[model samples]
Target chain A: MQLHYGFDELKDIDFMAFIPIILPFFAVGILLVLIALIDLYRHRKTRKSLLMWTFIILFVNTLGPILYFVIGRKDSERL
Target chain B: MNKFIVLIKKEFVQMVRDFKVIWLPIVFIFLGITQPIVTHYLPSILGALGGGQGITIDPSMTAQKGGEVLASTLGSQFDQLGLMILAISMMGIIQTDKANGMLAFILTRPVTVISYIAGKIVSNYLIAAFSVAIGYFASYLYVNYLFTDVPFSHMITALVFYLVWVLFIVSFTTMISTIFNSQGIIALISIVFLIGCRIIVGLSTVIDFVNSASMSKHAMEVLITGSVNSKAIDNALVTLVWIVLILFVTNYWIANKKFNHE
Candidate 1:
């Protein structure tokens, strides 16, 4: 099987033009995933499903890190 | 008043340590920027796919303005995803304290139930507000560059008016958090209620008057009309009443709930 759109078709795409637009999204997504990883590693005891959360945050793109932020970290009972 | 400041400070410190200080705004900024860039590129993306699949493209689908782009930042992004994040993030505000024995400890002090709950709500709401502002402003800057300069005053007005809706969201989630023991229940109810408001409000004017989600539509209207609509004010007043009612109920719930004291 071949890729649906070949490199010849990709020639239509202006890499230089698209790079500025795509870069911000990539930077934000990667940064957020890294932060998610750091938080997961730090809170392994309090947090549930270290492996699951790591993968979710790492693989799921924009919404993944958000899901991690919203639901991942275990809230401590003690103040 | 002193106690409120102290409590607010404590809550703020916790927020910083939780990394909420960093994640919340950055995520929103990403979302704010993402919606426009994606929507703008959608035509080209589809065009590329269309050629591969032998399909035609619609010109109208790609056509949009700076105002609409700015509006969708709220209409689509903040209204849907942002609302969910707000609900889930604040889901355990009081429940966590109750679960961990902190609620009981705090109560034994001179702090009123009102003050304690107020402190939690205020601090979280401040973060939500800051996050939204940064995200909204960043998106607006991109919109100005990519599309055209939207009316500066009108955009500011729309945001300020839209913020009433945000206030309701933050308070509503905090109240739901206060009432529920399970974070699962809290997240579920808050999301369902907010989403329900969006669905039902547009169906009837009576519902619209009370629906905080309408504020987003009204906010968009301000940009399109180039002036704040009176209805946005009316909706803000009604939502303020709702916010007060939610907080009141939350205060009552907190006062009565049984906590584990260790």
Candidate 2:
């Protein structure tokens, strides 16, 4: 009942093994950018702020896209 | 009752007008369809890139076998679904209201605090439930079409258990949203809580009885194996308690405090 991808197996990986691991992260990053762009177009006044968030999302990696979607986007909305 | 209905209608109207309803279902459906496909295809997709390194890619090994695919798919979806649906939905609702100074106006209406809170919670729950249901159905259809020899009964049971789990998560997110006025803080707290719960439950294996009470632990177990035991019941009860506690606190906040737009 070893229910996880063994850490031992993952640790013994090479460059080839890294691609799949990074794909989801990259996809998520792309998704964040799309969302930011869409929101920017909708709210023209906040285009600069939205672009700033898009950069943050691209640079932040693992949790960055999620943070952008949840918190960062909310920051640009007119309150 | 009329006021409550009116409040619910108001919430639904705002949700539709803002297009929050559309994005939620789209996200859930995307996660549902892609998680399994991505997980199933990742290794083979990587191998096809023709790296110079001698990486022997066995297609048989790459595709999940022996029923593990379902488990991994369900488990990953459960973990991700909370952040995607629950936290994101809460942030959309609460932050939009706070940002537009709509909270003050809504509060000034004839609607009672309880009614307003109830409307918010009920509508959010419905949206979450609908999204999860669509995702579950999509996953089921995809799996049935792509593979055979799946234990259909077990999959059905797992789907039912997962729906219950989603309810618990939605309720928990609603409570967290009520406690925090800022969307950033709410999202931060929700992510922290999810990670913390997983770690604590993972630690329970060495600690014996301690893991038995963890909600995420029970949820993962039920979701993967399609089995429900007393511990899962206990976890459900704990989640219910949290929902009630949060509602009480939210009602108190609304009654005693006035919101000022910053």
Candidate 3:
């Protein structure tokens, strides 16, 4: 089922309300990815599976950061 | 009581350190918000994806009701990715302690097996519950803004029933962690079984009584039609009983099973 929405639909959208609702989620997701990437880069030597985790944190959605936080780092049990 | 409370607190602290407390809900909220907005803007999404081809978005989808969006949130988003994160995040609920010799050390203490199991399940369940709540409410807000409001009381009724299933998932994960020795195995067992339950319920009425997935549909029924499903409630009750049975088994296994005690 395909429905078409043109520029007129943009006028109907409540960007004022919608942005607040969606922005943090976008920001958080991006920030987490960046944080995970930075961590992956800094701790490259200490990381158990550097190449895999970098790809994971970089490619996977929100879950990549979580996977890193939960298991990616070496001796992450200390976390 | 104090020791149990302390144990629960420790789990929460671990959750914070693991970044689960910080990220799980944010991720869930993001997922939850997507349901309403996506359903609302499916036309635009299709339009953008169409590229060179002509696309037709369903007219009915464009007017998705609040409850349907909420139901879709639970049915699609949570059932798939949510369960994975839950199982994956909790794979070490018991195995890590067992592997590190922490389980043996804790067992050597005066703490009862019941409390240890309860502490693990309760603390993790609390985070899961809170995360689900944040996600659910975020969806509710967007649905309210974008569609007609579903009855508040009805939504609550549905959630209360739905949370039972969530509790079962967490409790079941903890039990599987005890049975399995590997994180990969625990996640595999938990995900396959829970999702299998959801899928198989469709094939038979007898399975329906034991399948917890029906509870999700039941929860939505209360919101969408304002009618409760008695069979679904019965299934939830059976699920609750199964939860208790699993916990008892986990406790027994934890007490008797030999750990490498590294």
lDDT of each: 0.81, 0.58, 0.80
lDDT of 2 at B29: 57
Write one digit per residue (lDDT tens) for candidate 2, span B135-212.
655555544444433566666655555555565556566666655777767767866775555456556544423322
- The sequence of per-residue lDDT tens digits that candidate 3 reaches over residues B50-130 is 653556656778877788878888888887788788888888899888877788898888999889999999999999888
Clashes of 2: 1
Higher-DockQ candidate of 1 and 2:
1
Error of 2 at A76 (Å): 6.7
Q: Which of the numbered candidates is closest to the native, going by highest TM-score?
A: 1
Looking at candidate 3, what is the lDDT of residue B231? 80
Q: Tell me the tens digit of each residue's lDDT in model 1 across B1-262.
A: 8888999999989888889999999888887898778777776676566666634445444566788888888888988888888888888888888777787888889989888988988898899988988889878987887776899998898888878888888898888776677989999999999988866757888889888888888888886667777777889888889999998898887787634333
lDDT of 1: 0.81
Q: Chain B, model 2, TM-score against the native?
A: 0.80
| DockQ of each two-chain model | 0.36, 0.10, 0.35
Off by over 4 Å in 2: A1-79, B50-67, B81-85, B95-100, B149-153, B205-226, B258-262
Model 1 misplaced regions, further than 4 Å = A1-13, A75-79, B52-56, B256-262
Assess candidate 3 and give its TM-score to the true structure.
0.88
Q: Which fraction of the native contacts appears in each prediction?
A: 0.43, 0.07, 0.24
Q: Which consecutive 10 residues in model 3 chain A have the weakest lDDT in total?
A: A1-10
